[model samples]
Target: MSETKFKDIANQITSRIEQGIYAAGAKLPPHRELANELGTTPATVSKAYKLLAELGRVESFVGRGTFVRDKSALNQVIQPQHQELDFNFSILQPCLVLNLNALTEAYTQAAETLSPTLLAYADDSGHSAHRAAGAIWLQKHGLQSASSENVLLTNGAQHALSLLVETLTEPGDTIAVEALTYPGILAIANLAGREVVGVNLDDDGLCPKHLRKVIKQHSPKLVICIPSHQNPTGITMSVSRRQAIADVIKASSTYLVEDDIYAFLNNTPIPAISDLLPQQSIYITSLSKAVSPAMRCGYIKAPDALLPVLAAHIRANIWLASPINFAAATGLIEQGTAFELASAQLREAEYRQTVAADILKDFYETASGFHIWLKLPEHWRVDRLVEEAKKRAILVSHGGYFSVGDTPNCVRLSLMSISSRDRFEEGLIQFAELLASKPMPFSDFLN
Candidate 1:
C-alpha cells in the first residue's frame, strides 16, 4: 500500500505501454488481477491507474476497464489551453475566420473568370499576368523599380527563400543572419548545407558594426533580414539603420535577402533595404500574413540577371506555384481587396498592440506587430517559464526556439493567434501574474 509500490507499478505499466506490450486502445488488466499479479492491493493498482491516466497514458470508462489512450488523442487532450486563451504561434485566426465569406466570394469570382490556359502548365516564373500583378503589389510595398520582368511568383516567402538559397549559394557557402532571426531561415539553411553566421542585433535591428565583423570574419555569400516589423522582436529598423546596413552590404560580397513578410502589418511607410541596394538585394513579400495563407501567393523581386536562374530553380523545385492560387491573389490585388483586408488587419493589430501595452505596461514594451518579445526577469529561466505557462494553459514560445547561439532569458508572446480581444487580455493578465510570482523551486517540477 506504500506510495513507492504504486509508483513502481505505474512506471512498469508505462514501460510496457512504450514497449508496445500494451498497444494504444488496448485495455489494461482488471485492477484486482493486476494487483494480484504484482503482489499489491487493488487500491494500490487503482492508484497506479490514476497516475497513468494523469500522465495521459490511459483513460478509464464508466462501465468498462481502463484502456491505453492513443498517443495523438492523448496529445490533443494534454495540449495547453487557457480556459480558451491560447497564445501559441502567430496565426491570423481572427482575420481568417472573420473574412472567410469575403475570401470565398473573391475566390469564386476569380475562379469563374479563370482562363483555360491557366489549366495547363504555366511559365516557371508564373503567368505573365500574375507576374505583372505581383509587380504592382511589390511597388505598393515601396519597391519602386519592381517590374514584371524581375518579379518571380512563389507559393510563399518560404518557397522564395528556398529558391534563393538553392540558386545563390553552393552547399558549403556561408550565410549571415540576425542573431535571433526567423527559425524558418535557420531550418532552410541547415537543410541546404549552408553555414549560418549569426550577426548581433541591437534595438533598431541588425547592428551594422557586428554585421561588418561577421562579413569580415565569415565572408558570407548572403544575408537574410526582416527589416519592417522583424519577427519575434517586432523591431523595425530605422531609416538611418537601414542605410548603414545597406552601406555595409554594399561593401561586402554578401547579397541581401530582404524578408519583408510583415511589411503590410506596418501602419507607416518604411523603405525596404532593397530600395537602397536593389541590385544587391532580393526582396520577398507574400499575402500569407496580410491576406490569407491559404492563397499561397508570394512575390520575389530580384535582379534581372538572376531572373532566369530563379525561374529554373523554381521549375526544378515545384515546377510552378499553383496558377489558380496566383489568379485568386492577383484578382484580390488588382481589385484592391487585398489592400482593404490588409488595412483592416493592420488596424486590428494596432488595437491589439495597444491592449497588450496597457496590460504589460510596467513589465514589457512591444511595437505594433503580430507578436511581442518579452524580456523575463533574470531569476526566471525561459524553459521554466514556458513550462509553468503551459501548466496554466497559456502557450508561448521560448527564446531558445529562435536563438542562433546562446538562448536569451526571454519569450515571445504572439497576439494574433487568439481571436477574441477580451480573451487575449485575459491571457496577458494571467501571463503577467505568472511573471510577477516568485520562481518555483526546481524540485516542484519533478515527477
Candidate 2:
C-alpha cells in the first residue's frame, strides 16, 4: 500500500475514535478483517494501528489485539454530570475556590521573581530557602524538629509516600498500616510488592496494642499512621495515644512514617507523634490539601541520619522537585500566605462539616474534617448505597477502597469537594434520603 493510503487509514481510525464509532477501551477489529472492510492491505491496517499506539490513542497487548485507550481514568471514577447536577463528593481536596485569589497573586509574584537561581536545577534535596520554608510549614503542623538540613522536598504527599516506600523497604518486605487507611497508601504498598498488615484502629487513630501485635506477628520493617484527621475515618490521635504508639515503635525499633497530611484541619494543634520518636519517625505534610494542589509542594522531615539516603532517592527519582514550584511555595510560607490559606480551609471544612452534620445528623455521629466516614443503615449495603448515590449524580467513596482486609459497610463523603453550598447541601439531603430508604429484597425482583 502507498504511504498516503496508510496515513489515510490512521486518520480514518482517529475520526472513528473521535466520533465514538470506536468506543473507549473497545478492541479494534483484527488487522486482516479491518483491512478487508476498509478495502486496504493488512500491512496498511497494521501501520495505522501502530501509529495510533504511538500517539497514545490505543494500547496493544502482546496476545490481545489493539484496543482504544480510555480517555481518562479519572472521569470514570469522578462520574461527572452536568454542572448543575454534578455533586462530586469523592475527591479529598480543600474547597479550591477559596484559594484561587491567593494562588493567582502567589503565582503572579512567582513569575515576576523568577531568578536564574530559582529556575535552575536545585541541589538533590532542594534549595536551602525552600527547605527552610518547608521546615516552617512542617513546624506549623507540629513537627518542631523541622529544619532546612533535615527537611526534603517532594512533588506531593503521594510522591513522598512512594519515595519512602521505594527507599526504605525492599519488594518482599512487610509494612504495617491502619486497618482502614487511605487508598493511596494501599496503592503504594501493592505496587511496590510490599506486604501490608492492617493494625486495628480504635476510638483513637491507631491502636497501640494491635500495632505491637502486628509488629510482633508480621515483623513489618516500617509502620505508617495518619495521626491527624485521618482519611476515611476522620480520627485524630490523642496525645497519650500518640505517646503510647510511639513507645511501642520505640520498643520494636521499627521506623514510623507519620502521614499527617490532614494536620492543618485541627482547630487546636496536636503535637505530632513524630516528636515522640524524632530519630525513628518521618513526618510528611504538604500545601496540596489547603493552599493549591497545582503547585505540588510536599515536605518530608527526616532524621539527620536518613537525610542523605532520602536526598539520594529524591535525586535518583526526580533529579529534584522543580525549584520553580518550591520558589512559589517559599514565598507562600515565608510571607505567611500558606498558613493563612490553611486556616481558611479549616474554617471552610468546619462550615461544611456542620452542614453535613445537620443533614446526616441521625446517621453519622462524628464530624469536622475534609470528609466523613459514614456507617450505613443495616438495611443498606455500601455498594448498593454508592450505586444509588451515583445514580443521583452524587459521588462518594466506598469504604472498601480504604480497608486492607474485610471491607466495611460504610462510605466516605468529601464535604469540600463540591464548592457550591447549595449543591453540597442538596447532595447530602439526597444521600440522607437514600440512606433512609432500603433496597428491595432480591426475591422481589424474582416475584
Q: Which model scores highest in TM-score?
A: 2
lDDT of 2 at 201: 93
Show the colliding residue pairs in model 1. Answer: none
Off by over 4 Å in 1: 1-94
What lDDT tens digits, residue by residue, belong to model 2 across residues 1-447? 574686689878877875668966789999999999999889889877776665456789999899986543333333444666778888888888888888888888889998888877788588898899998888887888888888899999989999999999999999999989888887788768898888999998798888988999888989998998888799998999999998999998789999999998888788998888988999998888988777899999988888899999999889899888888889888899888999999988888888888889889878668988999989987655776677788888777667776658888888887878888888899888989987754323113
> Distance from true position, residue 247, model 1, in Å?
1.3
- Residue 227 shift from truth in candidate 2, angstroms: 0.4
Q: How many residue pairs clash in each candidate?
A: 0, 0
For each candidate, what is the lDDT? 0.80, 0.83
Cα lDDT tens digits, model 1, 125-239, are: 7899999999888888778878888899998887888889989999999999898877778778877889878898889999999999999989999999999878767899888
Tell me the deviation in Å of residue 426 in model 1: 2.0
